[model samples]
Structure formats: C-alpha cells, structure tokens
Target: MSEFLSHSHPRVALIGECMIELQQHANGTLKQSFGGDTLNTAVYLSRLLGSAAQVDYVTALGDDSFSDAMCAIWAEEGIGLSRVQRLPGRLPGLYCIQTDAQGERRFLYWRNEAAVRECFTTPAADPILAALPEYDVLYFSGITLAVLGEVGRARLLSTLGDARDRGARVVFDNNYRPRLWRSVDQARQAYRAVMHEVDLALLTEEDEQALFDYADSEAIMSAYRDMGVSEVVIKRGAQSCLVRADNRRYEVPAHPVHNVIDTTAAGDSFSAGYLARRLRGGSPQEAAEAGHRLASLVIQHPGALIPRSVMPA
Candidate 1:
C-alpha cells in the first residue's frame, strides 16, 4: 500500500507535535514523559527498523529544558532531528494522562500556546517545507492538521501535493480529536482533503466512527478505498486489525494482554512496527504481526514512550 519506494530503506518524515506528558499514577503522583502521535511513530519506527530506515520527526518546540530532554531522547533513539525546530521563549504543550482501573485513559491538555502552532508558518519553515518533497515517505495525522490552523493547513497541503508529484508516498493516521476542531464538518472537510493525497491509511475504527458516524468498519474501509488509498488498516484496539495491502485484506489479531497499564501510544507504535516491517521486506501479514507484538508491549507500560531496553531485541 502507499506508493512503495523503489529503495527498501528510505528517508521518512513523521510530522506532528511532541508535548510534555504527565501521567498521573493511582497514588496521585505525576510522572513526566513526552509523546505525540507522529513522534511516537518516529521513535518506534527508528528503533524497529534500526539501520534499515531513516526516521525523522517534523515539529517545533521551545528552547526549554523539556524540549532539551525530548531532543536528547530522540538522539538516543537514532531518530534524525533536522526537521525539529526550537522557537525561543515558547514552550511545548503539556498534557496529563489519567487512567481508569480497567486501563482506559482520559487526557487533559494545556497546549494552546505550544510552539508547534507555528511549525509551518514560521519564516524558517520554508526550507523544511521545500525539503519535504525530497523524502520518500511523509506521515502525519489529523492532530497535525488541527494544530496548524487554516493557513498552515493550506501550506501543508501544497507541500504534500509537491511531494506526491515527486513520487513520495503519503501515509496518514486518522487520529481524530473533535475538541481540536472548530466543528465536525470542518474536520471532515480537512480529513477528506488530506485522504485524497494519502496512499497508505492507518485508521482506528473507533476514531472513524466518532468522526464520520460510520456504521461499521466496512464502511470506513470503503470510504478510504473510494479515496483511492491503496492500503487501509483498521485498528480495533485489543481486537484484530484489518489490513488491506497489495490488493489483499487480512484480519490480524492483537496480542492478548493480561494487564494494560496504559495505552497512550499503542496505535502509533503499531503503525511504526508495521511500516518498519513492511519496509524491511515483510508481507502485510508479517508486518501486522510485528505491529501487534510491539503495540501489546506498549500498552502494558505507563507512558507513551517506553524504555528502549524493554523493546524487542
């Protein structure tokens, strides 16, 4: 799915935010971490693919201690940071993750002033936007669109078109957050516009239903196929993920977990593992298995990013 690159290992950019995340423990203590959808995918994809692929995060953050930590962590993961911008006097967003006993989570955000809001609008962004077309793959989510505002969204769409013209594949993750949008219709219009540019679509069925009021997973898959996306993946949290890659559809089940401490980056890591495996010459079925393996372990942890030491060797 997506426009498969001629080269096995290609340069890829994951565009989005990386906020300071605070996870509230049951004891009412807060543990700090950093996570954003595309950033999560970048980290895991780099770790999973290692030398096989080049993964980079595309976002802007403040020149603060928290941003320093984020950069240090990314460097440690071997993720390229050429596209990560540091705006002075501004800081990254902050969010708190609160979990229920069953391991479900609710998030509280305080990110309105995050530096990423100007990621694409800044004067320095011209070079990065121009360079995006040269990458083999560009991955982003609805959250990216939401944070960029209308003008920034238009600029991004123009770059995506330019990238596609150069044969760069566009991968989209439908992480819909209604609160971030002006209205459902606005988000729908934005999603529809970007989906047309997407080649490989990674979707969470629950998110699709929430945003589009789709009757079922089949409906969601049909919509993406109608948009001409060659590959569509429907992730159903602890259930099976439906993959439509290379003109074949496979229902791949998630690994059953006894204890899911947190599920912040479960889907993002799954996308990474899947993409990494596929790029490494694995079939869709094999890639899905790799995705599930990584995601299950991610959910068993407490934050969006887990220790690299705990990752699969």
Candidate 2:
C-alpha cells in the first residue's frame, strides 16, 4: 500500500465523467440512472470504507435536474461534493447499455458536449486543481484522459504531477474506450504521459492488450514495472487477478459466481474493494480476495450499482 494512505481517514479524490445511464431491457424499456468508471469506483469505495476514509468525486456537471439528481445520489452514498463543479448551459452526457444473454454489456454514448469535457479547462477549475494536491490519494482512469481532451488533459497531467510531488498516491485505472479517442497512437501517448506519476495501476488484461498491444499479462506487468509503478494489479474477468506489490507477486483467484446478470461495474467495484482493503491495512493477497469477492457479487446484479442492502459484510 502507498504510504500516503497510512494515516487513518485518508482523503481520496476520483476524477472522471459521470453520465446518465439508460439500461435497455429485453422488453425495450430503458431504466435511467447515473454511472461512470471512476464514479462507480467512488461509490463502491465510499460504501466499503464507510466513515473510515473520505471519498470525493471530481468532475464538472451541468446545472440541470439530472446533475442535481447525481449530486443527491452521491451524497446519499457518502461521497463528498466539495470538489464537484457545476457549469451553466450544459448537460451531462448520456449513454445506453444493452446486455447480451451472456451478461456482456455494449454501450452507445452521446457525450461529445458533456459539461465534464471542460472540467479542468475553465477558470473555476483552477482552485480544484490547486486543491487536488492536498488529498492523500488521487484516482482516475483512461476514459478520464480521453474525455478531458487536449487542454483539459494537459492541465490534469500537471495537477497529477503536483499531487505526486506533495506525497499523494496516484492511482490509475486503464478503462480504455477506443471510441473516445481519434486513434490508438493518440491514446497511447496520453496514457504514457501519466504513467510517470502513477503510484498504483489497476489494469484490465484485455484493455491493456488492446491499448498497448502487449502479447500477454507478463508483458503488460513488465511494461508497468518499467514505468516505475510501485503496485500493479491485472484484473482478468472470471480468472485470477495478478498483483505485484512491494516487489512481490501473487495470483489471486476470482470468486465463483454461477449466476450472471450484468457486468457493468465489475472492474470498478473490484478496484474499490482492493483499494478499500489495502488502504485499511490488508495485505496484497487479502486485498485481491476482497476485490474478487465484491466483483463476483456485482456481476450477479443488473446495473452498475447493486442494492446497498445486498452489499457484502
């Protein structure tokens, strides 16, 4: 675990875009909600940590009813709204999810003009960028990089470097979405830009392979290791997760789930579980176990968020 989180009640900030989610049912009905990669992780992390840590979501949302609803939901989940920004005359992005018989999900997005695209580019963002360094942990994903565009991304990179210089741990999740970028080379360049400041990397094996063209998991791990990341976790759905922490390696098996429903936030929940356990002083192996346990339960549910009542104890 990173030394920044050694203190009790460490503060965490997750930067990304949260969109209006429309879950398409088999009967052609759409169930509306809110979800995003880092947002999903923030909610689950807040739930897992309870009052043990402070989780704040950093993003810009429109001054609309949907945005208001999003804030209400995050507050209910115990996520801090102090870092969230509200912009006028814009709306949050929208996405629709269609699930297959195998519980695999496909998404169609309408986010080109979302308010979060200007999150780190506006004048109001200066204070948020200045305050980010004060947090114990800073978390973001590849999708965040893609959505931030060039200017926003450049500002974010500077903030990340500053945050790291202040002894804060930077956690990166490789939630790659090819549709969000102009080309693979552009995505590669963006991802490589932030690698230097990342303390912990939570990557999906398939996404890593797709993003960097790594032959296998070993190559992916070797690449991040060479990038100077202190901790690396490879999440392979239904298979074992690979972890490299404290110069030690471990392969933790995933929990078995006979029933499959929706695989919306499996990886996000796993990251939340892993970070929650590791930050609370659990071993790497124990953290991976917790990740697997939570992920297995998430995939058995129907949306990005499962009912709080069904959460694991």
- Tell me which residue pairs clash in candidate 1: none
Q: Which segments of candidate 2 are over 4 A away from where they belong? A: 1-4
The digit string of per-residue lDDT tens for model 1 on 1-313 reads: 4435667779999999999999999899998888889999999999988888888889999999999999999999999999988999999999999999988899999989999999999998999999999999999999999998898889999999999999898999999999899899999999998877898888999899999999998898788888899888899999999998777889998899999888889999999988887777778888889999999999998888888889987
Least accurate 10 contiguous residues by lDDT in model 1:
1-10
lDDT for residue 106 in candidate 1, whole number 0-100: 98
Best by TM-score: 2
lDDT of 1 at 110: 95
**Stretches of model 1 off by over 4 angstroms after superposition:** 1-3
- For residues 1-313, write the lDDT of model 2, one tens digit per residue: 4432667898999999999999999999999999999999999999999999999999999999999999999999999999999999999999999999999999999999999999998999999999999999999999999999999999999998998898899999999999999999999999999999999899999999998999999999899999999899999999999999889899999999999999999999999999999889888899999999999999999989999998889
TM-score of 1: 0.97
